[model samples]
Target: METNLADLPVRIFHVLSRELGRDNLWVKIVDFDQDPIFSMKQLEIDNFLKRDNCCDQVLRRWGNRGQTVGDLLRRLQLLSRTYENEFDSIQLQLRRKFKILRWVPDSEEQVTMAVDEETIKLECKAQGFPCPTIKWYTNDSKEPVHTGRSYTVLRCKCSTEHQYKCVATNEIPEGFSFSEHYKRPGKLWNSVLESDFVDITSLVRDDELCESCKNFEMGRLSQILADDEKVENKTIPVPSNLDSTLRAADKVALIMSNCSYVHLPELMTPHCDAQTLADALQKMNYKTVTLADLTLDEMRYFIREYKKLIGDGVYAVFYFVGHGFEVNGQCYLLGVDAPADAHQPQHSLSMDWLLSIFRDKQPALNLFLLDVCRKFIPYDAIGAFVEYSEQFKKFHRAHRNMVYGYSTSGGVGAYEVKGEINGVFMKYLKNHVSMEISVMSMLHGVLKDIENDPKQIH
Candidate 1:
């Protein structure tokens, strides 16, 4: 009856007293650390003096051995209830703190002004959001306009010159909206140029050359003599006996661009222009496929299949229209989800890898259309055009059959569209292509037009 719960010997005595009642039950509180005797009389008296209804009823029938068992079961049930309550509270808090919502465009939108130009357009659109207090800014400036609860026209004056973007912000945290850049340049520029020297080794005998064999022989001899003399000298080699007609049968075309993602409206115009070129090629009985429509493996497979179908007389064209970067002196075509980090080289597809695939096919004409220009990097802390012009020059040197076209000269950012067509360069190319324009003429015309435009200094 006076058993201390913390004392093991006393609790044991209480348990034994309940088990055997007064007759056989006996246990004593003993110090195991200092030897002590247990007494039966003490235990019997304790059990008789302090027996409750729950314990006494079971003890009288079952000799009181079940008292400790009833106590342990009740303690465990109380602990389980406490744990359940804590778990429920944690789950409720998580449900209240997080949510997922779809993005919505601003309400009460208006096109305040738009000036149409051949290559671009200048325009403004009024947009209103909840809790007003909106601010506006453009790519041409860092200063923003803050208008309180009033209509604001985001000013953009050059839609044809280049793509323009607008940003709106509010006082509330995480409250902001932006309009996609718009580009209205109706035409795109595609120009291809090669170094003055020719790689005569890569060409077959039937290939055409500007110099004749006799002049080439004389020029080689003059170069050897000039080197011995150490005098400034120039040698003009004669043309080769190669027929231009035979070389025409072995022509191949390669088309490629690196900017493909059309997340912004400014990209639409150029993207459509690229499509127009594809459409033109299709009309001319040439096979064309946009990279967006195929995976890397699929593109490779199609190239192989096309080579098989067209055989030796085939003209192959490859076009690319998306983001590009140069790494370790190598050009890479960035996929839609390409990351900005150069360390993640696995995300990009190498230009050489694509060219190698074509080389395996041994096509006669290799025309490569690269509409990729260095521009504002998507989601990057630093923006710079990873210059790979030297790498391209090396590739051009190695692949004699290749015709390379860049949207701008080396070390220049290519123009992009602000609206419906994704690329400004591709848009112009398509407009001419749709009119049954010849490939060579289209390249020359677009480049000339772009050079003349005062807004663009090429």
Candidate 2:
């Protein structure tokens, strides 16, 4: 415990110093109670009183700089001339509580199609103080692959996207760790960043600005733009009206539902919900794609594909009907294959992350309709399971027209009515979609239908 306390200064300095752009920052832990000079009783204990009992070394850690805390402070103020405002700012950062503002990955996932031996670097960046120590590890080992500072490099073993975890820890406040899986392409740069589970893209490549990378990019650009040359890998027809034809329609619907649980009671309503909603969306002039009973990775892949399809003009509508629950204020949409034992399954997609997809795409309007509940989950501790998705949704300050519609309000369990063809939300949504009404009116109908049910209450 003492050793841990001793490491605190260095730990704080690690994260804070990097953010301060200072390489030589150090920590000195001074107990206010133990201070020989400038304590509450320090004025009474003069130089004569100090020589009577206390050691000289204990008297002045700053060593010849000053006699008291006030003198030391004045000395620091005098020395502040060299750094100007930066010294005060750095001091303020250290003197305050530890915090992480936005820890993000710098770049998209790196995929290399390299065959011959080549080196690739992956990086993680952190924005917090004291600056967090960035370390890399692989293959589930306790020993790190790389430690001290940011970024790590590895030689290519194959066309491998080697997975390395970069951890940034202050061990005082919240620490962040993220996995960076980058393939061995040509030389890249930087290290990994910090997060709860944020897999940020890699940072912009400084190494790639070299002659070889520039040449490669230019060649690729030439190949893409070459109108006079015959393209060998031509799949799509080149239209004469290039500017008019490139972009597709913005109004789209993503309908995903999971009914088949591996160990839990299978839900029949979600599958029914997805199919009916797809039909309704089609009638409403929305291009809808429905994916049902998907495993964890399959859901992620589909969302990724959906992200690629969305553009700036997209008015995207996402509908998820599935078993979902909150763990420590974070809500997760469980896939068909989510583990029964794991409280926080890696496979379970986060609803906040789902909304971030549209933020990245910068959509015109994004509406999320979640028909999620774990009412059927065979858990005896009914009181223990809490609802936090509503809170989670509120936390993200969306920059666009974003609406999060749940089947019911948070903390209340949604029930599956027996003999009903679909879930309450979907049944009414299907009914209202055919009536040629707005989505707001459709939702109002859903709420009214749910309120009228005998077995359920929101």
Candidate 3:
């Protein structure tokens, strides 16, 4: 993690200076492990010819910062936005040399502890950009025994030793093709990383217990046995049908997909993915509006138009796919012309703004399904263009009819698997969106399906 920026390779220094500008005051040499500080520098215009693979090392070093290549490229693109004369040509040159980088969970082995007679604790250490998800499972069981970094199980003296498995995973950046040469095989850093099995011993022997304590333990054990006997007689409840008040005619959907880009890295599958979801919803009798590759002004225009379509007691869904980033804990969807380095609010649609606009519509369900990265990207400055209401901060708290379904966790990116026609989120969403069941029920099914596929572990 040690880096001396001033001592950087001559090739990398050239790339930064040339792209970020020799005198922009945004390029500096310092510790990259911390946030980069921008400063001005001047270099002699030597007759240096660029090599074919000069940027490869630059890519590797940046990727190690727990950032995808797409994120790094977007930042560079924004910082160089003022270079309008040769912008397209220079950006294209940079793009040709870059490939998308996906993050995976690098997990350590499990740490187990026998905390108490009634509880056995297991802890697994994992490290990743957004922190990996941990799930603990018993031997040969398809379902997880517990979830989180620490898991506790009820200990019984009659039980035998058992093996527990720990799994850690994080989302990968979406919508980029990877060549076979860049792919890692049989490595733990491949989306889902699992730890070695940790065995748990039986509870303390009966000889170690006093007479009074033994009697108390036996009484509790007998009660548990009685509860198990009753559980066998219990019946599984069926999912209730969709509410009678909710009609297909009362449903509406707005789907936006940004595939092409002028200032940011272009995505490959968002347009097609949006269409697939639109078609699926249409079959279920919901009114659908699907649009693709919109700029900032166009996105705002359409959102305003879509807001007029909502009515009282109606089910409204807003689905977006494309480049998105989080700043100051607030999420924004990037427009095609959103600058890489400045005026972000003017060019991007704020989720809070959207929620504020819709909360007053009194829709029966205001659901948002966002399939984008939630990475925290620091911004240089803000020039307000969009008027966001502070009331939306408590919108979710005041409304019980709102649901936000994210493709990935906060500070992590979503994935678009290579060779697939759609991103992983939309791929599974299509399977359950048309079901005639409650909205929460449908979402649960989609989550279960995604969890079952290791490759789809975003």
Candidate 4:
């Protein structure tokens, strides 16, 4: 939180005028320096200051008579020192940027320490005007294992290998915080930059291993196992360089989550998940259209109209959370009205068709997030699902700016705990969407979070 001397005066002046009346500030300035000529205009002295509006005029008057900005700053600092108690309170309330300085073990090095007896100590360092708090977690656990700059891990058997990660954060009055990088420690900074979840060590105790554990490590380095799903609300810093480009583009999001179904099993988290995502996107200035439980025809109708909102530089996002399946390498989203026993394209919306429509609109970014299962259909249903026509096969736009982020890989089922608010994918994604990185890079971070998550690791 090192202050920029150039802007420091303006910030200090703003607080002084609000805490003390304009008349009192003007009188104090004249008496503090005992200058023979008072340059402040009478109109400015009497002006009703609503926030910082009148500060500009007063500063302009102060600068007119052979006085530099630095001169004004020097005068302000003198006043600040004279009223130390009051100035201290005001300075404490002023905003400061938070950032991570360095990690004890740099994640980029990918150092693999093999230990069977010695304990390991891990630490992270950060600095801000108001210091940021540090928290540590093992693997994908939501709750912090330790809170502070450093943590110690005891030696464990091969059965307990795990990765450890640390995060530093501080709140801003403005709900969202800005981001910037620093060259070294103790430099003036910035956000929630995290250490790569790193494997602290690999231990192989041959005598302590079970049959399955023996086969799992088969001469290779021991890998961490298991998934745990607990929800931790964290912020991602949007870097300054990408700020303008992300904010400049027209952003529109269409969120459709179907939980109630006539033929398929009813879900518990879709409604809650959709709302959570909508709130997060809206904070980032996205125009969000959130809908639920749409039928096949309704899905088609809404999508057709949704594309109209996309223009040359628009950033269009389409998200669907519901029952879904893949067959012959093609994916389909199911509707509430889909049949129970026999499901076909007629009762679902084809992904190819969705991509084709968006490709023609020429948006700057086309992002699709599917928070549903992609397991293959039964053999009996395969023939019916593989009805792809020649047109569908030829509709490939490899050069288009499109990204598909699926919750689970093909032939795998995505899970939703009965009482959880969000599915596995959205649980990690909501924390990453606002990051000031490329769309792919943001999604890659989400992927890493998912990989570390104990519940979603499988």
Which candidate leads the pack in lDDT?
A: 4
Error of 4 at 124 (Å): 59
Model 2: residues with Cα > 4 Å off, grouped in runs: 1-248, 327-330, 374-395, 434-437, 455-458
TM-score of each: 0.36, 0.41, 0.43, 0.45
lDDT: which is higher, 1 or 2?
2
* lDDT for position 120 in model 1: 20
**Candidate 3: tens digits of C-alpha lDDT, residues 1-458:** 13343444666446644553433222222223444432212331111113333333333445455544345444544543233222322333233232222222332334556567446777665543224567887777899868886787545332224678788775432342322322337322236667788766645322212324334433432332232121235432222563322222356787878866787777777866887887888786666766666777867876776675555666788899999877666678977777665335666788887876776676788899989888866544432422343445676446688888877768888788888888888888888887788888888787787677678644
The digit string of per-residue lDDT tens for model 1 on 231-334 reads: 12522221266322222222222233323343311233333445566667767655443323233444455445434322244466767666664444445555
Candidate 3 runs further than 4 Å off: 1-249, 379-397, 456-458
- The better candidate by TM-score, 2 or 3, is 3
lDDT of 2: 0.52
Candidate lDDT (C-alpha), each: 0.39, 0.52, 0.59, 0.62
Over 4 Å off, model 4: 1-249
Q: Give the TM-score of candidate 1.
A: 0.36
- Residues forming the 10-long window of minimal summed lDDT in candidate 3: 40-49
lDDT, residue 172, model 1: 18
Q: Which residue pairs of candidate 4 clash?
A: 98-190, 227-454, 227-455, 228-454, 228-455
Residue 78 of candidate 3: its Cα lDDT?
54
Ranking of predictions according to TM-score: 4, 3, 2, 1
1-458 in candidate 2: lDDT tens per residue?
Answer: 11221133554434433433342221122224755433433353344234432223333333333353334343334444433233444333334333442353333422112222234455455444334466666644578767654443423121122455667663232222111111124312133344332222232211221334334433432332332322234343334664432333446677877777896667867866877877777776666666666778877877765664455655678888887865544456887788775344455787666766545566666778888863333344333333424434554664646766778766556567788878777766677667766667777887888788676634
